[model samples]
Target: MSSALPPASSGQPPVAASPLQPVTAGILTALVGFGSTFAVVLQGLAAVGASPAQAASGLMAVCLAMGVLGLGLSLALRMPISVAWSTPGAALMAATGAVQGGFAAATGAFILAGGLIALAGFWKPLGRMAAAIPPALASAMLAGVLLKLCLSPFTAVAVAPVPALAVIVTFLVVGRFFRLWAVPAAVAVAIGLTLAGPGSAGFDTAALALPKPVFVMPAFTLEAAVGLALPLFLVTMASQNIPGLAVLSAFGFRPAAGPLFRATGLGSMVIAPFGGVTVNLAAITAALAAGPDADPEPARRWIAGVTAGVAYLGLGLLALAAAAGFGASPPLLIQAAAGLALIGAFGASIAGALKEEADRPAALVTFLFTASGLSVAGIGPAFWGLVAGVAVMTLHGRLGRLTHP
Candidate 1:
């Protein structure tokens, strides 16, 4: 025993390892990312008029694109830069409902949005313009867009009390004790209930199949381009990529924004014909890999992103199963799970929006208008929220300067 437990010469205690290893953190990040939002993505696609097959293809395409881009960018920059399908953009698509030319037109809009994102990298002015958006307003708009989804837990409970309540309760309990595992755990409960509860048709594991690409030839129209593409690009940049970059910077990794944007844009373009929406830098999930828990050495944390990418690829292969399960389950169950998953994000966005007192009023206006689900000239509330918020802030600033001067 004495020989086996060699006593330390020094009086100092030995250092303990981190609770989370890089690989474990990576796997957790992937699970949280995909588990939390995949249902919402499916709903969003359906809202925009994607058929079952098309939606399944979109899910697979997005998963693969995000995986490949996440891996490539993380390796290239040697930074834990994770890419994701734009969750906010998907939400916007859902809110916007079916467009003029149907899902094909929506696909065209996706391509245009991706192209604009790529252009932002090449054009300094455009990038600067996106950057110039007031942080408070941007966060407000994001919060507003998420408001409806965040409320779905309650609504789901009303619709299907037993299953939805089970998911909700599980999420709350798990989130309190093990925050990261909340969504995945809730998802597990939902799946369990779906398979075991009365009137349930047991899940057929054998039915799991590899996702196949289904091309939707894009039909671009000015309405789709203006109504869908522009707003999608804006929200994806303002709400997602910018915050994702900020998260990296916070962790002392200064990845080049231009190249990262370009990479995601290119990935989105490649997947667009196959029903993928915009691929972007991940804000929420990026934190999981970029933080100290992933690895003490900043340089080594890129491995976490690579691991997450591999996880995403595996999930992509199983997209057909997920699509089928979600498609067959009660919509309320999916909504409840998604709403619970978004609670943290919703809270963060609201806090961010209201942090500065001077910007509070403008931020509130933005949030209200966006949450109101207003549409003008076929354009959705997100664009209007941005416009209104900026206008209010601008006017307030000008008036204050005049008064003070």
Candidate 2:
């Protein structure tokens, strides 16, 4: 943070911005070239009804798009604020789809959810309140919220030894050895394993073909709106966006909530037509792209995020690639890998909720309700849990005020 650029006569020092070197910024973009958008593209297709072919097309499309976008955006913003399709958002799509309607209906629901986020982002007080949320509780809630995703790999590994063991071990070892690029290292291993299938031929290319959206016009029944829209909105905001902002800030970058929301919203809106319904700021991926390790200098890492965003935009374009490559994944592997990733997030969230002596009770209430796995008329348990916790605390605070005052 040197001010050498400012002349003495100016009396104010010029802010010494970070340099945009290839290793500093470009390396991060390359790491996420597949590590991020690719994983998400897989998860997303699985959520919708995309077959193996559709998945590949979608994967190829999204990957190239995301990479190009990441490069351009990172360079443009000179900030490392990255964005990706929300993994949780995709999970929500899958979960809700299981309980409800078709992909088009889900896309409608997805856009509705994004609008709500846009609303939240635009409101000054809401943004501040979201920001003011006790950092620890925010973190704890995030950890608690994501715990399930991190543990999913065990089930996969238990059933299929070769692939699961290969992915998990590589990720761990590479992560341990090459701290900056461990996840990518692991992903490369997974790709290699996929290519060199246990005994048979790997990656059947005929399956990797162009993906055209099977246009299922949405029929928005009250059931669809109630069951789907409400829950998607809640999880994307509470479980994902809230923590995303915090992560960005923690890494010394400002959370540009408005642009972040609008851009994701717009992206979701864009691909909504082609069976690519939902997209949002990626939480774990954001953590990966925004961390100080993404670049040596805290300030320079903003370019990393920008790089990720650009990558996402690219992913949006290659519908065929996305379709072709999105479905070769083992369900159990996805569940395990995602579950394991979220374990720490879940723990930290619960810890944050209860970290303060005064907030311990509230945290407990939140944890229990969230863990209850209840769905009220289709809304996830989180909304209800938040309400119950906040309501009880408000009541308690009011009663105490009457007695003391």
Task: List where candidate 2 sits over 4 angstroms from the true fold.
Answer: 1-24, 33-41, 48-78, 94-97, 125-145, 161-163, 188-202, 207-216, 221-228, 238-256, 277-326, 395-405
lDDT of 1 by residue, 1-405 (tens): 111122455878655546457778788788889988887788788888898788889999999998888888778778887888899888778777888889999999999999989989988789887777777888898899889988998988777887888898899899899987888889778877776767767776754767789999999988788878988988899888899998888888888889988888878888988889899999999888988778766767888998888888888987777777776645567767877777787898899999988889989999999899888777778878978987898878832442244
* Predicted structure 1: clash tally: 0
> For model 1, what is the alpha-carbon lDDT of residue 335?
66
lDDT by residue (211-237, candidate 2, tens digit) is: 444443544544546555664555566
Model 2 Cα shift for residue 372 (angstroms): 4.5
Error of 2 at 180 (Å): 4.3
Candidate 1 residue spans exceeding 4 A from truth: 1-20, 195-206, 398-405
Best by lDDT: 1
Residue 49 displacement in candidate 1 (angstroms):
0.9
Separately for all candidates shown, the number of backbone clashes (residues 3 or more apart, or on different chains) is 0, 68
Model 1: per-residue Cα lDDT at residue 382: 80
Once model 2 is optimally superposed onto the true structure by TM-score, how far is the C-alpha of residue 264 displaced, in angstroms?
A: 3.0
